[model samples]
Target: MTRALPSGIGLMPVRRPDDHRPRLDRLSAVPITDLARRFSAATPTSARDLDRLDGDLMLRGFAPVGTGVLRRILSRPSFFWMGKSFRRVDDELIAGHNFFTALGGSRGLPFAATIGPSVVDGRPAVRIDYGDPRLAGPRLTRRLYDELREIEPGLWLGPGFLRIGQRRVTVCWFAVDSSVGYGEVR
Candidate 1:
């Protein structure tokens, strides 16, 4: 008979963050390659994880590599975007929208996206794609694709890519945490 080791025995004692804030801080300070490696190693966000994240998801933006001071500053919260709100539209598609705090937290520039399964770094991932004109506005904005992996329970990490002339370039690194509250967008 096969036997399983008791809990915490014959297993790696990996220390994980109690919350996403400290974890995000650590990821933001690491080299971009290290962050990508972590993302690559993380598990793909499962349907159960998305179901648990069906409300307003908090966001933390990390500056891309080689960016100047201003870009790094703008990557911080409340500067570029606040967070994203997600709702299950169908059995396989989750409708999503982004919110900003520019005018006292008004939900303006309401672009749309869909979170679905996709491949990233030759592995499975939950990709937020804005390629549908009906969902996302403007061709330029539609070229953005962000793939997410579940780093920890209720915490996800992803790299945002912008397609430019058939080439995808990494624009920024971001984290989505379902553990925090940021006032749902109406």
Candidate 2:
């Protein structure tokens, strides 16, 4: 029963090649202890929710639901083509962007998303927005929005529902291996 972001809130800003100083929300500004706690509570639960846990949860932007539960959505074939970037601006702030291609292939559009500090779901979680991380820059980045909960220092997980053909499938978790995530890509 989760609802999508409003129609025109726009995408979160991303660091562009030309901009030397870009303004972004600093996660450090938010309470650390609370953020961590909220993240742990959002893990996969119940039969349907628990099923999403797989391999490399951190890399997929989620935390270990439990000691044994894992998540591997990022490397999943659906997200293999996905590329992302992150830069540590301050202590708690991790600036980044996620580029995915699903609806794009059929709709002739591109998906570029950004995540940052926010208060949603009645707790502290990262707000993910689809569109140009560059905003109104030359690229068509903004499209939709999703909220991610941090499981640990460098891992996150968020529910992603997508429309494929006629049915909308719920992609319960996504990983963002913030640590080594950007080592290969820009």
Residue 20 accuracy (lDDT) in model 1: 36
Q: Which pairs clash in model 1?
A: none
lDDT of 1 by residue, 1-186 (tens): 432111111122212222335655555577777778889888755555566556556677876767768446744544557566666655555666665555445432223333455545666677777664445266677788787887888788888888888887888888877776543233
Q: Please provide, for model 2 over 1-186, each residue's C-alpha lDDT reduced to its tens digit, 9 standing for 90 to 100.
A: 432322221333221221111111122223334444555586422222212222112223332333223234423333433434433333433334444344342111222333343333354455444443433322323434455654544455455544454443443334443433121212
What is the Cα-based lDDT of residue 101 in candidate 1? 56
Candidate 1: regions farther than 4 A off: 1-20, 68-71, 108-119, 183-186
How many clashes does the backbone of model 2 have? 15
lDDT of 2 at 161: 42
Candidates in order: C-alpha RMSD to true structure: 12.8, 14.1
- TM-score, prediction 2: 0.37
Candidate 2 Cα RMSD after full superposition onto the native fold (Å): 14.1
Top model by TM-score, which number?
Answer: 1
Q: In model 1, where is the ten-residue run with the lowest total lDDT?
A: 4-13
